[model samples]
Target: MGKLTRILSTAALSAAIASVSLTAAADGTTNWRMATPWSGGPWLERDAQSFATHVRELSNGSINIEVFPGGTLGSALKVTDSVKSGVAQVSHNYINYDYGKDQTTALLAGHSSGLTPEEFMLWMYKGGGAELYEQYRLDKFGVVAFPCSILGTEIFLHSNKPVRTLEDFKGLRLRTSGAWAEIASRLGASTVVLAGSEIYSALERGVIDAAEWGSPEMNRPTGFQDVAKYVVLPGIHQSGGVLECQINKKVWDGLNPQQQTVLRDAAKLSVFDSWLSSSYADLKAYEELKNGKNEIVRLDPSFIKAVYEETTKWEDEYAGKNEWFKRVLDSQRTFKKDMQSWPEYRLQIGVSEL
Candidate 1:
């Protein structure tokens, strides 16, 4: 064959190889279903939706996630089970809701031991808390998890009657769950566990005297302000809330390295975005509540101190009972202790508080 004919044949072979490579890469595309523990319309649900959007965009549409807002697949509290059973490839929910399965779950979600939102984030990302959490999920549920959302301090409680001191808690029927419920019970308040959707009606019908949910932005959408005019502050039980995104282990393993990196970074971005958006919304909600008939009251300092003491005692007792709980608590305690000194030094150096 002549030189020109040989060159033409080589070019045609190169084109065919390129087409095959493109097809192989395109075949890696995936579509996943993600379920959240919150119903449609709340800031939390919006955060979950935003996370899905970020993942898709970051993956350049090679991976698409369809988010199912609260209870669409099943009860919100059972989201972990849904992901574990492969009913859903992913889920966004507070891990503390599953504290019944293992007390350590509360440490990842929200614990009353007094870590602020920033502190929790620091511990999770830098202080080795994230690794423990990931291991716990894999060992217990056969799933992979990430901290996808972080909430500012929650409102302590919303009440029909004013709560002035520890005495006021006597005979008060409260709707809450996890360690907070235990603390409330010790304080003489009868505690009941109610789903998020049930809180408004329960308060309106006088089924419960008080309840604590999310931040002002989250609670406003539930219309808690309308049902309970007296809003308490300084959420002592839950200083902050963390939402986790869990994926089925098989699904997570199927992802390529780049896809895994996108998922991880997308989750971190969601955590930051949710924190900022919720903080702004809470400020606005606070202003609106002030203008309305609602009265926002801060819990008395002495009462808060008492609650903190109780929380410490409860933490000791519970940690002694569960090995995993002890492991997480020890890790957080060490991180908190090490970081606590810096803030003191900063204050001494005259840095103004924010």
Candidate 2:
């Protein structure tokens, strides 16, 4: 080859290599798809939207999350598998929705510990449950878990007939979510499992005599009160349940440490935001219901005690049969016992507090 031709070829090669290196360095921004089971108007949907915004702000637009609400990717039940199988890069849903995958996953939502939303947040994040979750549940699914949000104590049963006593719940066909349905069934109510969006129609059509959707404020928009005039108070089943944000393992590892930290902080903030929404909405809903002539009946203390005893039975039976679940419950119970000493009374309350 001519000397001039060789010099030109070497210069072109160097320039091409440098261009490729620059391109790689500039690939700092990451775009992820997040799937949510919540409909566009639900508080959880708002939570996801806020989380996406915070993530963008924290990462300075270097990381972008696109949310698909209404289970556009898949139903709430499919969230765990979707992220695990790489069908979605991330998912937002309650841990109880995936109880079958690993019973331990539902421990956070279970009635056993009687954790308030805030205490659950502290335990799930600062306490060792977060570590164990990452170690067990997420690792098993090839994903990572983040405590994204919470719904404080589910809305009590909105019923056609008032449920003030244990006798009233007998033969009552009530719609519930997750393991709570099982608990309700054992409590002598005929339990029907239905999604939140469907509860209104179900109640109206006599498919369910009663239901617990969420906080009263959250449920009011669902039109439950329009169909059922009775609003039962004091949620016993889901006392401020925790919801999780799950990321595909490979997608999580690809992010830079700074980007990951931003995501973690964003999710943590979302938890607080969701808790506040529930608290504010419940207070407002209570006032509205009272003024609107809706009968708000607190469950009798006797019934509450009976329900707690039954829940303990359920927990004991499951713990005895499932070793992994047993370990998680034991760990959570220990944590709860320790948290009782915390200055916050929210940490100290139990089913008795209801």
Candidate 3:
């Protein structure tokens, strides 16, 4: 090549490198864009913010994350891919949001009658759940993840039609997400997948007959109570679940050990914070719903019994289909069985397990 051509090529390459370098922090600090699926200030959204606060406070300004509401960086439901593809360096996600990538994600996210919120947290830290999830996250999405926050059991359904029995769900059009949608379909409900924003309009216009969102505490302000005739209790479809923080693998690899620990510790703190806040908010939300016009309907024991039975079958069937599904299901089942008698012991001694 001519000297002029070679010189021009070198200069162009240098300019491209300099422009890319400018996206990083000038002070040698690590900056991240955290995309989350939640736009409203539900506990989920606050969980993302709370995690960022913990990271900032604990990292002492070395690692800074800018929070972006859902859809700011990409499709709210697809932020895990957004992180993987480098549209964002990090994301706060509902682990099951990536169910399309790997079905076992729902097992990580939590499912019907699997574990309570408290037990799920315990299992993650104490029962080898965390290690398995890290492996799964890395393998499935090429991201590093922590269970950053959790929700208590959600309301089963907020429906204009009363859903008190197992038969009541037959032919019912339900708006839901993740594994519940699959299981609900198996139980004779025609399940429709809708984002949080689409639920209200679909419900109001009779596009869906029923919907299940978050816990009563998380649901109160959504005005579901105003439109639905009945608010179903005791979130059987999902006992409880962890919300996840997903970081790009390359970004995670770049951080020093201390910065990594800061992120881990911050994620743990977010979980603890969410537990306390959800406990309080859910109590108040339950009372607030009691005063609202909607009729509060508790799922019949028979209905719950049937759902749990089907839930087990669902797990067992998937365990046969997917290796990760089997591993996660086995771990959860083992952890849950190991704690089976604790609730009875607590009740007999006048201590509440909750």
Worst 10 residues of 3 by lDDT: 15-24
TM-score of each: 0.87, 0.84, 0.90
- CA lDDT of each candidate? 0.81, 0.75, 0.85
Candidate 3, 193-263: lDDT as tens digits? 88788888888988999999888788888888777889887788888888889888888888889988998
Q: After aligning candidate 2 to the native by TM-score, how far in Å is the CA of 218 from where it should be?
A: 1.7
- Cα error, residue 204 of model 1, in Å, equals 2.0
What tens digits encode model 1's per-residue C-alpha lDDT throughout 1-354? 699998999798656533442132446766677877776765445788878989989998887777887777667779988787666778888888788887778777876778888787888899998788888888877889988888788888889988878998878899999888888899889999997879999999999999998777777778888999898888888898688888888778877899889988998999888877877788898788778889888888888888888888888997899888888888988997989777655554224665
Residue 318 C-alpha lDDT in model 3: 87
The Cα error of candidate 1 at residue 286, in Å, is 1.2
In candidate 3, position 72 carries an lDDT of 84
Best-to-worst ranking by TM-score:
3, 1, 2
**Model 2, clash count?**
2
Question: Ten consecutive residues with minimal summed lDDT in candidate 1?
Answer: 17-26
Measured with C-alpha atoms, the lDDT of residue 253 in candidate 1 is 84
Best by TM-score: 3
lDDT of 2 by residue, 1-354 (tens): 699999999899757533432122256766666777776665456788878888889988877777887566666568777777665777777777777665666676545346777778778777776666666655456678877877777667889988988899989999875667777888889988876668888899999899987767677678788899898878877676677788888777877898788878998888888777767777887788779867888989998888878877877888998886787778877887887667665443335554
Positional deviation of residue 40's Cα in model 1 after best superposition, in angstroms: 0.9
